[model samples]
Target: MEAYNFETAIKPFFWVASDKTFSVCLNAGTYKPEIFEWRKDEGFEGNGYDWASLAKVFLEEKRPDLAEDIRFDPEADMFCAYSENPDKLKEFITGFKETCENELQIQDLFLKAEID
Candidate 1:
């Protein structure tokens, strides 16, 4: 199988909010990067299986403090996070890319019957 390069494959951009909070945005294929308000009407339906769930879990595991800042909008297919510290924001994005790559590997293995 060909290797997928996360750094070259996925690019993340930053948006500074009015309050000066640095927000990171990633476009995963068909998704367009945009700010989304938190939805109180709908509940999370991923149940730890989807990409959003995996990303949240990964962030929580790697950086609990930044995890709470994460937001994913399935309808918009956007993933975003806000951080006051630019360095922390950068770290989160780097970690996020790694998490995505790891998840992708597991998915590939499952599809290829290499894993049960």
Candidate 2:
């Protein structure tokens, strides 16, 4: 079995709400075998949710295997996905961004801690 060290791996870019109530991290954009995580910001008290639906739909349609790894914690308002293939992850991320911008009508989001 192999182990992954995310901190040492390529850093992720985050998409966060304007109010900083929630965030989605696109871990290791093109870096192979990475993970994506989404969570509600600490101290947030709004009812806003569904941060993972678009990504989940994309994954389910394109990479069912990876979708199987999708995990959600409603209590924590978090979700995550682990993929061994970098290309596939990138595809999903692209779609996710587009969905967020167009379909979800979330325009206040922006990339955080982007890597060069």
Candidate 3:
């Protein structure tokens, strides 16, 4: 059986560039019951909570350095890591991609995944 893609046309990722800063925007826009159910045991109430819980585990347990340079905006419903230095933003994007792949089990996550 072929693997199905949860989101393709409108991928859950995007790139934002401005002046000398670059940011990787993680759009967890909306999630259904399965997401809430799957992570309920982890104490995530869904939506922003899901991102927070996942980021906490990924940053604290997986990559600590990336966490320091990242920020989540609840009002905008976006998680963005920006840096004036290209190398710094690149590093953050790499670790963020790993978090989605390893933690979220998004194996086919590529292209617009914010990788250089």
TM-score of each: 0.48, 0.35, 0.53
**Segments of candidate 3 deviating more than 4 angstroms:** 1-11, 29-36, 41-45, 103-116
Residue lDDT tens for model 1, 2-92? 7975345446433445466666654433332110112112433222223355455556566788766555443234445666676676677
Q: Assess candidate 2 and give its lDDT.
A: 0.37
Reference-based TM-score, model 2 = 0.35
In Å, residue 42's CA in model 1 sits off its true spot by 16
Off by over 4 Å in 1: 1-19, 31-52, 68-75, 103-116
4-111 per-residue lDDT for model 2 (tens digits): 643323234343333423333543223211122332243222111233443455555545765543443332333343344444454455555554445223322212
Best by lDDT: 3
lDDT of each: 0.47, 0.37, 0.50
- Ranked by TM-score, the better of candidates 1 and 3 is 3
Tens digits of per-residue lDDT, candidate 3, 43-116, equal 54445545544545555555676666665443335555565665655655566555464534432222112211
Candidate 2 stretches greater than 4 Å from native = 1-49, 61-78, 104-116
Clashing pairs in 1: none
> How many clashing residue pairs appear in each of the predictions shown?
0, 0, 0
Candidate 1 lowest-lDDT run of ten: 32-41
